[model samples]
Every structure is written in C-alpha cells, then in structure tokens.
Target chain A: MFKPELVNTIVDAHQGPDGLLTILHAIQEEFGFISEDAMRQIALRLNITRAEVYGVVSFYHDYRTQPVGRHVLKLCRAEACQSMGGDTNAAALLARLGVDWGGTTADGRLTVEPVYCLGLCACAPSAMLDGALHARLDAAGLENLAQEAL
Target chain B: MRIYIPCDAAAIATGADKIAAAITAEATRRGVNAHIIRNGSRGMFWLEPLVEIVTPQGRTGFGPMTVADVPGLFEAPATHPKAVGLVEEIPFFAKQQRLTFARCGVIDPLDLDDYTAHGGFAGLAHAIKLGPAGICAEVKESGLRGRGGAGFPTGIKWETVRTAPADQKYIVCNADEGDSGTFADRMMMEGDPFSLVEGMTIAGIATGATKGYVYIRSEYPHAIQTLNTVIARARQAKLLGADIMGSGYSFDMEVFVGAGAYVCGEETALLDSLEGKRGQVRAKPPIPALVGLFGKPTVINNAISLFTIPVILEKGAKHYADFGMGRSRGTMPVQIAGNVKHGGLFEVAFGITLGEIINDIAGGTATGRPVRAVQAGGPLGAYFPPHMFDTPYDYEAFTKRDGLIGHGGLVVYDDKVDMAKMARFAMEFCAHESCGKCTPCRIGSTRGMEVMDKIIAGQEPEKNIALVKDLCETMKFGSLCALGGFTPYPVLSAMTHFPEDFSKAAIKLAAE
Candidate 1:
C-alpha cells in the first residue's frame, strides 16, 4: 500500500553489495511486510530478479511477506529453554491460542512464532512479546501475558 | 548520589528499562537528587534489572525489581525488600574473575569518558606504539586462543593474516552467535561496544586491514543498535576512519546485520552473508586468511576473540596470560544457564570443574531437582552426566571428553530430562539449520531424526539405536562443516551418558 515515491526513496538510499538487505530492511520497517510489488521494484532497482529477492526474503526467519497481528510472540525453543520445560510451555501456549508455530490467533490479536534462542537462557523458558523478552516463563505467567496481549 | 541499572537486552528483556524509569520518577517524587547510570548486567541474570545504589559500603544490590517496588526503593534504599546486600559480596558475583567483562555492569556503555576512565582504549594506545609485529608477538606470548569454539591460537591466525599479501584485506567480526544457551557475545556487544570497536581497530592496525565488518545476527536488534551508535561515535572522535588518532594508518568499520542463519556463524559462511548471498559453508584449503570476504585476504575472528585483544594489549600479554591454566591462558566467560537456580555469566580461569560451576556457583537447579545432565558448550557440545562433572573447563580437557569449549555456554538439565527426546532435538535442529550443501548434514540429519522416532516408538529399538550410531559416525566424518559434523556430539553423548532415558522411552512405547 506504499506510494511509489516512498518505495523509490527507500530503494535509492542503499548502494553497493549490501543494497538488497538494506533496501529490504527499510521497506519492512516502513511497511509491515514486503509486498510483491515492492519485491519487483527492489529487483528492478538492485538489477536482480524478483525470484532472487523472494528467495532471500523466504530464507530468513525475520522477514515476513504478509501482514502480522497486533502482537508478535516469539517463544524460545532452543536447548537452554528446552531444558527448563519450554516444550511443555510451548505446547500449552500453542494449544491455548489454538494456533501452531507461525500462526496468528483467530482474532488477529497475537501471533506465536518459534525462535531459536533469545539469549535469556540463564532465565530459561523465555519468550519475547513484540521484541521485549520475558524470561523464567511459567504456564501461568505465559497465560496471563497472552490474555493481556489479547 | 549515584545508582546503576542495566539497559542490556537481557536486563531490558526482564523490564530493566521500565525499572530505570520508575527509579528516576520515584527519586524525583522523594526530592532526592540521584544520578542513574544505565550499565550492563553483572551477569547475575536471576537478579536482572538488578539495581545498585553506590553506598559508602559499596555498590549495594537490589534486584529482580519491578515498577511497583521503585517507590519503596527511594524510601529505604538499603533495607528495600529486593535488596541483596553489596553486589560484589553476593556469592554469585563474588566468586568469579572478570577480565573482558570487568567494566560490563560497572560503567556507562555509551560514555567514551566513562570507558576511558575505566582503563579502556589503553590497549589501542599501546598497540599504536608497539607497531603491527609487536602487537602480534605480544598476543603470541600471551598464548591466547580463539574463544569461539575452534581453540586455534589467535596470535598464529593474526600472524597468518598479517603476512598475507593483499591490497584490500578486511577484518570480519563474526557476531552471528547462533548457538543456543550462548549469549556472551550479545551481552559483550550490548554492554561494552567501544571495547569491540577498539579491538577491531587494533586488528586493522596489526593486520593492515583498512576496512572491517561486524556481521551480527538480526535476532540481536539491541546489540545492532548499540554497535551502530558506538561505531558512529568512534568515527566522530577520530578513533575510526581516516588517519585514526592522527596516525598514518586509516581503517573504518561497518556493521552488517545478518538474517537468521545458524550456519553463518561459520567464518566463510559469514563472509558469504556479508556479500549479500545465502550463508552456505565454503570449503577450506585456501583458508580465510588467504582468501575471504569477496575473495580478499581477511582476518575473521569471533566477537569474544576480538574483544579480548584490547585487554591483552592494555594489561601486557604476560599479565593476561598468567590467569588461566595450561595453554588456555585467560579467563573464560562461562554462561551458566537452563535449569540452574542462580544461572548467570561466570568468567573464571580455565580448569574450573563442572561440578563446582553447577553446584557452588549456580547453586544447582532452580526446580530443586537433582542435576541430571549438563550440556557444556552449545547445541553441538556433548552432554555430561553427574559423574563426569569433575572435568575441567580447559580446551584440551573438554576435547579429551569429545566435548568442545564452544563459546563456553553451559546449560544444566534436571532429573526430568529425557535423553531420547534431547537426542532427537539435536538432529531436528541440525536438519532445520543445515544449508543443504553437504550430503551428510543435509540428508543424514533428517534420517537421524526418523531413526530416533522409530526407537522412541519401540519399532525395532535395538536396531534403531544401532542405526543411529552408524548414522552419527557418517555425519561426523562426512560432513563439510561443524553444523553437520558436531551435531553428533549431542546425539551420541546423550545416548551414551543417559542410556536409561532412551531405554525408558522405548519401554514405555512397548508397554503401550
């Protein structure tokens, strides 16, 4: 939904070998997700094909092609959290939300995604709500947070 | 009066920012004039958002604080409910030697004056005087090795890069710390960014590299922001860019944000990512020293390895080298994580036993259950049972047990852990993260997961176990990089140390 001028402004700001990543990041920051039209414009600006842009976008976990919910919940599933009952907590959270990994709730209030680690392993079973991390998360704590997010 | 609270990602994750604001507001309301310095974590993560009041006695600690408790903190700073006595006296913080992290929680990360006042940049100043070879020789004398898993002598690597003839050599800092249970790099970068900036500048001076790139994972947004700000500030102060500090040598650095790819933590893969491509592992023969980062000779070191350089130079190589045991000569920032009660960052000399780390320092599992196993290193590291806790944290000692001191991340597990499931998770993680460039890592991981599932399902359990062993051997010997190669360490070690857990999984399936 971005205007052509705004798209061009973002694309024009980057130069050199890192232009693609820079352009994509700027676009994602300005807009919620990368659109197909944006990809085409990026391809044209960077002198690469849309397929290459798509490949890069899909490969990385952080880039989203579609719009997301109001709140993004990233639950850590790495070894450190796993050692602290993250699996059980992850399962409970997913079941309560009625969504799988990377799925958004029906009301568009929350989206639960699986992240490898958030470096809060010392306070294990951590989760990040819209980029703010919460550690030592129990079932109750998570449920309360989820309700608050809703 | 002065007060300190962490603005580190780990601290911020636990609401450190909110706590700082509350403290500021509370102090104003109470008509108390106080200076609030947002420092980094002391590594006592359990006491996160750990606030300290600089009392005459010392930096008195009050922790795990929230907004609600801020008002009370102003009323009675020392006698607050969250007060845990002096920070240095707390058993968790008292029992460790912190070298690279010495200024972590003590100084304002963004303040150059604070950093200089705290014995920072002395290394760079010394390196400028010593010249390239002198700096390299001192590092050699210090016996410092790469803190990022490989344990290769850092001085030797620098010497190689220094000798390599390239008009456009580069220094690539591998900040893509993808390993689970490892946050030392992130913490260091977020807490003390100028240290890294100084270290890389020193590398540029020693190796004659005029340009550098710090490739950090996108997951660490806070670290990226911190580093960007520091790099700009350093540039403004002439600590970086053309003719740094009025010296003839010119070096500049840029921060490259990486998309999530565990394999990119590998040096060559990081270079590929830097070049705006998929992070597939490259074969080594020419080595990164001869050819790296768009085929130019490059000096690629992990964040910790580079960060340690400034200290090595400032303190004199011998002084830093005198701290650790054997060839692993220096302190290690061991992250005590997972189920541990007082899990935090404990930087100690080499040769500290795992038993002491888990029992004495960490205070055992937070769940109050008996420690079942401890996974030292990261996902690729081996799992050690309770009996093996006597093994020291030295590089060679860990290698002797088929374990790696990879990033010095230690994750503890309690009695409820299932070895079979943990083994499966290793393969699952590898399969997901594999770049699909090598056969063993790409296909073998999926096959290993299938075999593990069969064993758990009790379908020819004995045969499945044998198949897993055979598969792991192939993946170990046949894989191109550590991602595929070291995945077996966790899988095989779990099955070897905790065979009973595997048997129980199969037995339960059989009973069903």
Candidate 2:
C-alpha cells in the first residue's frame, strides 16, 4: 500500500525551504505512519541520507514509525489538565483500556498518546480523538470516550 | 433570522457543532428561515456554544447552550433559560480593552469584505504611506515588546532587519504557541486570520522583507486550515501577491506547519526546524536578526506582537502605548485557565494584579476550593502562591518576584494540589522537551527529576533538596535556551513558597 512513486511525487512538490518536514507530513498523511521504505525513498529523492531523515522523524513526537490504530486519542498531560484531575481521569481511562501510555489496545481500535497541550486549556482535561477535540472530561467522560473509541 | 455560533476549537470541543446542527434541524422543522454563521469565540469560554441572535440593539447571547435549549431559541429568545442579555454587555467581555482581538469573534474570519468592513487592512494601507523608515519609527515610538516571554522591543528587532545589508530578507511570525494555557495565537488565527496576514505584510513592508512564513504548531489543525484558507483568499484578492493594493509593494506569505517539538517555539530552534534539521538552539552573538534563516537577516516576532501592529499604525503609537503601566505598554490577552471558574481570555492592560485576575475576574476555583498556587506563564514559568497575588501583572513586576509572564497564560490550581509533585513535573517536562543540544538542560533536568523522586520517597530529603538546588543553578545559567533556563523557576519557587510540601515530615504527617 506504501508507494515509492507517491513518495517521489511528495518530495518533488516540496523542493524548497521546509521541504523535508512537508514531505514527511505528506507521506504520513498518505499512509498511517512513515515506514523505513518510504523514508529511504524520500532520502533518495531528496538527496539526503536515510539516517538524516530518521533523525528528523525521531525528533518530532508527531512522526510515527509504525501504523496507528483506528482511533488515535491524544490526552492533554499539561499543568492545566493536571489541575483539573486529568491525571486521575487519564489513569482511569488507561486502566479501563489495559494499555500504558503510547500503547494501542489489543483490539487494535484505540491508541492513546500524551500531548502537552492543545490550547484548549480553558476547558481543561481535553483530548483529541482522531483530530476532533473533546474537553472538560472527568473520569467518567474519559471512560465513556475510550469505550466508544474501543 | 441570523444566528451566531462559535466554531472555535474550544467551542467545538464542548459540542458547539452538535448544538448548531440541533438549532438548524429545529428551525427547519418549525418552517423558520435561519442563517447560521460560525464565528470565533468571544473568549468567554464558560458560556461557549454562546448562541447569539441578531437583535436591533446588538447580538443577544444565550449559552452554554445544549441541544435541549435549541427548541427554545426559536420560540422566545428573550425568555430563554440560557439567555444572558447582549454579548457585548457581559462583564467578562466588557471590562477590558480589546485591541489585538478587536475583530476576533466579531467578523466572519474568512470573508475579506467582512474583514475590510471591520477595519482590517487599514494598518497595511497606512504602512504604505509611512514608508519603511517611518513605519519602524512609529513602532519604536509605540514601545511594544514581544508578547512572547522575552519582552524584547519589537521595533528594535525590525530596525535591525530593516538596516541589515541583505538583498533577500525574511519576516517570520512565530505561531508555534507551545505554552500550555496560551491560545491567543490559535484564537486570532482561527478567529481573525486576516489581521495576522495584514500584520505580517506590514512587518514585511517595514522590515524590507518580501517573503514571510507563519510557523504554526501542528496540534492546531483547525488554525492551520483557517490560515491556509485565508492566505489563498488574500492572494486571490490581491492583498498578499505582487503590488498589494497597487502600492508598488510586493509581499507574500505561506504557512509552515511544525512537528510537535516544544523547543521549536524558540526563535533560533525554530529557524533550525524551518531549515529541515533537528530543532537545536543556535548560539547568540550573530543572533537571528543578522545570520538567520539561510544566513540572511530576518525579523522574527510572536504572533500577538505582529497582530497588534495594525492597531498601533491605525491609532498611532501614543494611543496604543497609553493603556499599560510602567515599561510594559499595550494590552496583553491574558489566558486564565485550569481549575478556575469563568476561565477564558481577558485582553487587559498590564499592571492588573494577579489576585484580581484569579479571584475577581476568573471567579476563583471551579470546585469551590481556595486558590492555592497559580503558574504565571508556560511550563517554564515560576509558580506563585496566593500570598504573592498582589504583584502587578507587569514584565518587571513579575521578573522582580522570580516569575515571567511567558505568553500571558495563568494556569490556576486549587488547594488540593501537591506543590512537591508539581515541582517534579517541572523537571520532568523540561527533561522530556529538552532539545538535547546542551548538557545542563539535557542531563541536568533528568538528574533533577531523579533527585526530586528521591525527595518524594523520603530518602535523604535534605541532601536531595540541596542536590536539586545545585542542579537547578546549573540548568538555570548553563542551559542553551529558556527550556532549561526557566525550569528552575517553578522548582525553586515551590521549595521556597511551599516548603512544607517538600518536607518528608509533612508528607508523613499528612499520611498519618
């Protein structure tokens, strides 16, 4: 499903400043995650080493090397959320799902990740499920969200 | 009938979209013609999904509206249970000065006509008449500092880029707002994007830089989408492209999305990231003003600082400068968040006390608990206990007390918070987000966390606390950037202000 030619096209389109990050974003947008083959293809087209590409990919928290689940839930782990009992709610959700931080459920339906902030701090205890944001989540709210995602 | 509903990310998070859909369905069923416009949030977040019906007087408000309240909207808006009079009359909105966010939540963000009608491009138009030197002079006169943590004079930064001998210069708007409680950048971009487009164009004109890039954080997908749409629209309308408004000035801009890296918020690190490298901090002496972004002179400013340009140009320097106290001039869109009730963005002049902001403005803790500690600024900022609440919200005032108003965000905490755990989190966060460019930050933060863990475990508390103090000193002075430098503020502030929380005896007492 990961096409080398599509990677070439993405690399070609972003040939100027910020080309590498743009290309990686495009590749990730096309596929669920950036594979070694795709990174190699990108490096070849961009005239950079595979290690250089990997360094960038590894540096940013957004870039994933492996495929994600059907739903990716990003829970806010910042101070604002912490003040609103986000730690307890997050712990409860993770416990209910039986997955650690950055872990995917056994059913392959949900993957939970910790994000520092989403700029929705006014409504603390925020989470983003598959790009749509949910906020003001208590323990029960987080549980119901995880259950729905699972 | 015309209806206004916020499409802001915060509003959407709290089910604004569902309420909008419910209102539409209910209106259709009743055979009533209703027009729904997705506006930006008014910063009164507690009352979000704050539905407004256009009345003869003004936009009459009703919210935090639910789907249950939708049917009543059409029946009798005046008698609706959620009705809260006119939107402008709300105390939270009416009390403060709203310059930077003047058009936000007021106009349809994408509509150029709507933007123009709301006095959007007047600054850019005025900048064309003033010329580059005059524009710089006006900014210098205004005394506007960076709304980002540093509080550097914006005029001087532009003057550097303006005079620097470079055939090709650049204007970069730092929209990578990574601060936890801050959302002014996101709100402005999502709400009134053209203001940024216009402001950046003004910066380009003032600094003699034709090319601009708004480096936005990828977490704000909606803001990115909104900015991109506005950029394309501005281009099509001849506002951004060559010979903008036929003034013989050609300036254009693009949105560059940043991957999730907290250090990328730093100007030098941001430049490195922009160049497709690891976002490591570049040492100073040939600061980004001189050898920046592909070895050319560049003017980098925070999104808020740049967005405020138009108003300064339109109203003149003194008018904008007169609002604030001391060296800190102009209004800051202070984001009050976390455990507080009525938590939202309040754009007020500097010198308002933190006590007023938390207790009076924010209405204290949402859980009805006593306010314990409040973190002024981002993760890197120092924590202020309630006793220190009288300190005015000025740059010098906060810095005098060992805190910085980094990005104008205040994350409040209730009495239930454990200061020791919060202190550990500061070190942990710094270690997690460190760029690994310098040893003091990279290694010191990890060591600090470990020492904190030891202190928490009641294992040689006095020795570990001393070690942490030493580690903090190294990180504070020796680190490459603010990420490591300011991490000590919260840790030391906690230890000093809430000593009982850090003591093993207190922990034992609490347990018993």
Candidate 3:
C-alpha cells in the first residue's frame, strides 16, 4: 500500500528551498500519514538526512506518523471555547466515547484531537470534522457530531 | 431576484451551505428568477447565514435562517420572521467604522470585476504614481502599527526593507492567526482576498520585492483555498504578474499552508518554517527587515496590516491618520467573541473604552450573568478585571496597565469562570506549543503547569503562588519569543486579579 514512486513524484513537484512543508503536506494528503519509508524517500530526494526530515515532521503538530481513523474531529480547547463550557462539553464527549485526547474510537471510525483554535470564537466551542467546521457546540451537539463521525 | 449568502467559514459552520442549497431548490420550484451570490461575512456572526436580497431601498437582510425558512423566502419577505431590515442600517453594523473590511460580506470574494467595482485596485493604481519613497512615507505618516501583536510602525518596517541591499528580496504575509478569539484575518482572507493580494503587491512594489508568500495556518483551509483561487485569478487578469495594470511593477504571491505549530506565528520562527526548518526562534540582531527569508531583505507583515495598506494609499495618509487617537492611527477590526452577546468584529477608531465595547456594544454576557473579566488581545494578553474596564482600547493605554491590545481580540468571560484553572491552561498551552529552542520556556512551562496543579490540589497554596510568580519572571525575560515571555501575563494577571480563586478553600469549593 506504501508507494515509493509517489513520494518521488511529490518531492520532485516541490523542488526549492521552501518545498519541504508543501511536499510533506502532499505526501500526507495522499497517504493519510507519513510512513517511515516515505520519510526516508523524502530525505534522499531532498538531499537531507532522515533525522532532519523527522525533526521537521515531528516539530509540527499537524504532521502525523500514524494513520487517523475514518474521520478526524478536532475540538477547540482554547480560552474562548473554554469560557463557553467547552471543557465540560469536551469532557462529556470523551467520557461517552470512552477515549481521551488524541484517542481513536474502538470501532476505528473516529479520532478526537484538541486544536488550539479554528478562528470561530464568535460561535464558541468549535470543532472541525474532516476539514468542515462546526460551531456553538453543546454537549448534545458534540455527541451528535461524534455519532455522525462514527 | 438577487440573493446574498456568506461563504465565510463561520457562516458555513452554521449551515450556510445547506441554507444556500435549500434556497436554490425553493427558487427553482417556485419558478422565481434567483441569482445567488456567495459573499463574505459581515462579521455579525450572531446573524450568520445572514441572507440578503437586493431591494429598491437597499440589501434587505434576514438570518440565522434554516432550511425550513427557505420556502418563506419565495413568499412575502416583508412578513418573514427572520427579516432584520436593511443590512447596512443594522445597529451592530452601522455603529463602527469599516476601512479594511469595507468590501467584506459585500462582494463575491473571487470576482475581480466586483472587487475593482468596489474600489479595489485604486490603491495600487495610486501607489504606482506615488513611487517607492512616497508610498513608504504615506504609510509612515498614517501611523499604522503592526496589527499582528507588536505595535511597530509599518512605514519604518517597509523603509528598512526598501533600503536593505538584496538581489532577491521577499514579502511574507503572516497569516498564521493562531490566537484564540481572533478571526479578522480569517474573515478578510475568506471574504476580500484580493485586497490582501493587492496589499502584498503594493508592498512588493514599495520594497522592490517581486515574490511574496502568504503563510496561512492549516486550520484555515477555507482562507487558503480562497487565497489560492484569488491568486490564480489575479495572475490571469494580469493584476499579479509582471507589469501589473501596465504599471511596470512585477509582484506575485503564493499561499504556503503552515503545518499546525502555534509558535510559527512568530516572525523569525515563521521565516525558519518558511525555509523548511523546525520553527525555532532565531535571535533578533539582524531582524527580518534587513536579513530575512534565506538571508535576503524581507517585509513580513500581519495580514490585517498589509490589508489596511491599500485603503491608506487610496484615500491618502491624512485621511487614515485623522481617524484614531494619539499615535494609534487608522481603525482596528476588533474581534469581540466568547461568552458575549452580539459577538462580532467591530472595526472602529482606537479610543473606545473596554467597558463601552463589552457592555454597550456587545450587550454584555450571553449567559445573562455579570461580566467577570475580559482577556484583551490573545492568549498571551493579560486578563483585565471589571474595575479596569475604563481602559481605552489603545496600544499605550493597555501597555500602561501592563497589558497589550495584541491582535485586537477580546475574549469576554462571565462570572462562572474559575481564574486559577484559566491561568493553569495558559501555562499548559505554552508548554504544548513551545518551539523548544530555549530552556526557560521549555522547562518552566511544564513546571509552571505542575505548580498550578499542586496549588489547585490544595497543596501549599501561598508557596506555590510565589513560585509561580518567580517562574513567570524568568519566563517573561529569559524566553526567546513572546510565546514564552507573554505566558506570564495570563498567569500573573489571574493570580493578581482573582486572588481568592488560588486559595485552598476556593479549590475545595470548586471540587464540591
């Protein structure tokens, strides 16, 4: 399932001083997560060491080493959301799902992670399910989102 | 019939897309000639999916609509339960001055014709005549400060970049809007993206930089998508490529999506990230203006700062300078959010008091409770107690109180909030997002969080609070960037303003 040729193509497509971030994004876009083999191929193609590649990848919170579930739900844990009972709602969702932060559901249908902010403070307690944003989430609304994801 | 619907992410989050689809189907079923335009948000988020229809009077508004309300759009709109009269006359919208966001929620984001028709490129056209020095002087005269966090003058920054000798200079727009209660940059990017493009282009012309990059966060996928589309369209229209608008000025930009690092919002860290490295903070000896972006001169500005440039150029520096109080000239698109009624973006001149904004304009807390405190600026900004509500929304005014108006974001909290927990979270956030280049921020944040936890657990409250103060002092001065330096604001502010919350009895009360 891991394609080495695709990594080469991705690295070649983004060839410059500022191509690493773009290349990593593309690889993740294609493979869901960056594999070790993919990392090796990226280092070789970009004339950097595997450690350097790993450093860059590991430094950013967005880059993932392992695959996510069918759907990824990023819940806001910042001050704005926290003010509007985000902590309580988030705790309720986590308890119901039997998972913690960055945990995947038992059925592997959904993964819940904490994001700082999605810039939707006006409608506090926001979340992004597979890139589409949802706002003003109550405990029921969060549960509904979990159900939808599952 | 013309219908206006917001394509802003906030609007979309509240089911704007579904509302649009329902309206489309209903119009088709009714055989009414319907032309739907997906415009940007007007910043009145409470009335999101705020639909508007062209009337002889003006664009009459209706909103917070649902799919169920679609059929009624075809009927007599006058009797529609959601109708809120003319869009421009709405009190929330009418009260403030809208300079940078004038075209937002008004024009189709990607339509070049619509953008120019709303006086879009007139600023760039004037900038071409002003030449480099004139442009820089105008910006300096306008007294426009960095809308990012630092209140540094935009003109001085441009002048430094312009004078710096470089074979290949660059313009970087810092769109990494990681602040919690801020969405002005995101709204502008999603709504009036061309203004940003035009602004950056003007910067390039002023500073002799041909290439630019908008470093956007991955969280803002809609902003990235909108900017990419607008960039492509601008290139096709010959507004971005070489010899833009026959002005013989060559400037083009691309959107670079940031992987999710909050510290990347820092300029040096952002430059390093742009260069494909771990977003560690570089020292400020050389600074970004003279030596930046692969050792070349770079003019890195916040998206709002750059977006505001066009208006200053078009209307002249004095016009913008005359608006604000003291050194803080021009208007700020102050983002009012979190637990507050009438939460939205209010772009106004810089002299309004915090009490006026929180009480009168925002109509107080959404929970109908008494206002406890407001964290002006972002997470890094200090928390202001109700007693300090008279503090004006100016840079110096905030700084006088040992606070900052960073990014012009105010996250209001009701009386139900526990200050101790909020303080601990700030330390936790810093630890989570720290770039790990320095020792104080790297280790102090974790230690700070642990100490706060111990205090919360009723284990030696006085000593732990004192220790937190000491650690905050170290972090405030020792850390490399604001990420470490400013973490103390929230921690100390909470400890200073709400001393009762940090007590052992209060912890027991909270637990009970």
For each model in turn, which proportion of the native inter-chain contacts is also found? 0.71, 0.83, 0.88
Candidate 3 chain B lDDT trough over 10 residues, lowest sum: B501-510
**Measured by TM-score, how close is model 1 to the native structure?**
0.98
- Which ten contiguous residues of candidate 2 chain A have the minimum total lDDT? A141-150
lDDT tens per residue, model 1, B168-260: 999999999888888999989888889999999999999999999999988898899989999999999989999887778899999999877
Candidate 3 lDDT over residue span B405-472, tens digit each: 99989999999999999999999999999999998999999999999998888788888899999999
Report per-candidate DockQ: 0.74, 0.87, 0.92
Write the residue-wise lDDT of candidate 2 on B1-512 in tens digits: 99989989999999999999998999899999999998899999889878889999999999899999999988888899999999999999999899999999998888899999989899889999999999999999998999988999999999999999999999999999998989999999999999999999999999889999999999999999999999999999999989999999989999999999999999999999999888889999698889899889999999999999999998899999998999999999999999999999999999999999999999999889999999999999999999999999999999999999999999999999999999999999998889999999999999999999889888778888999999989999999889999999999999999988889554695598
Candidate 1: give the clashing pairs. Answer: none
lDDT of each: 0.89, 0.92, 0.94
Whole-model alpha-carbon lDDT for candidate 1: 0.89
User: What are the runs in model 3 whose C-alpha is more than 4 Å off?
Assistant: B504-512
Q: What are the models' TM-scores?
A: 0.98, 0.99, 0.99
Residue B462's lDDT in candidate 1: 83
Number of the candidate with higher lDDT, 2 or 3 = 3
Question: Candidate 3 on A30-139: residue-level lDDT in tens?
Answer: 99999999999999998899999999999999999998899999999999999899989999889988999988998999999999999999999899999889998988
